[model samples]
Target chain A: QTAATPAPAETWLPTLQVDTPQQGFDLAIVMARRAVKTTQPDVAVLKAQRPHYAGDAARLIDVSGVAAAWFATIAAANGYWRD
Target chain B: QTAATPAPAETWLPTLQVDTPQQGFDLAIVMARRAVKTTQPDVAVLKAQRPHYAGDAARLIDVSGVAAAWFATIAAANGYWRD
Candidate 1:
């Protein structure tokens, strides 16, 4: 019973000229993925790419919120978690 | 019997001075996560970041190779996937 969070696109969207909410979300996700691939070509995560960009977000992922979800598993598996 | 793959640490490790394979792996993963976070702060993946850089790679992920894994899911969800 809550509202969906407004992404950065909502506030400055008119300036950037993004059309819809789904468009903004899509744009953000692609940018994130590209960031990882272009920056680190040797990481294990890259080793598992499915080519079509339809991968899952991991059922076991979620470290309080989305901000930490991306790094939680790797840090714990690497034994770098401190709490 | 099977042999584990040799990470970058094993090759030409004398000059760059990466201590061990584990260290190399850790270094690579960290670099990947940092690249994504720093480059795409507004992205949802960043929102899901756990600060420790240990997030799961996603179960339903795998695009034949690592290159495509990074952008696979969002592309499909965004209706950008073709094959």
Candidate 2:
């Protein structure tokens, strides 16, 4: 039986739930209700934030890019990256 | 004094640390060591899990897309989304 291992990094991130079974992609469940309720949201600013409100939308496109690099190194060590 | 507000969504996602000032984009800091140390990483499987590491990298592209739609709605209610 699989040992009761420590919670994964994703588990630590309560907001972002990685639902591989359902959507297959990681799900980032944000708490907008709390944020809107207390801090007060700015429609104009938030709206203006746009698809890539933070900056270059492309930057966020590849969540696994940085991670893939590390994954490759791991593959090489364990002899997985080879074709 | 400012109110001691509850932690934001990002705060909950300990894995993905958002560094706005540093890179101007949200930083998704995953724990590779823990993932690697345990379960024994499969270089092939992990490497094959490249680009998207799931399916289409494009899906992960717009982290703010889904969030933006909701953000704008709030803007309308509180008058933040309007141009």
Which candidate's lDDT is highest? 1
Lowest-lDDT window of 10 residues in candidate 2 chain B? B20-29
Worst 10 residues of 1 chain B by lDDT: B59-68
lDDT agreement with native, every candidate:
0.35, 0.30
What does the interface RMSD come to for each candidate? 16.3, 16.7
The local distance difference test score of model 2 is: 0.30
In model 2, the runs with Cα more than 4 Å from the true position are A1-20, A23-26, A29-40, A51-58, A62-83, B1-83
lDDT of 2 by residue, A1-83 (tens): 24687654332222221223222122222322222212223455334434542355564434334333323322332233233
Per-residue alpha-carbon lDDT of model 1 for B1-83, expressed as tens digits?
23675554423213322333223333334444555556886776665654323223342221112223322322223233112
TM-score for predicted model 2 compared with the true structure: 0.19
Model 1 CA deviation exceeding 4 Å by range? A1-16, A42-83, B1-83
**Candidate 1 residue-pair clash tally:** 32
Output the number of the DockQ-best candidate. Answer: 2
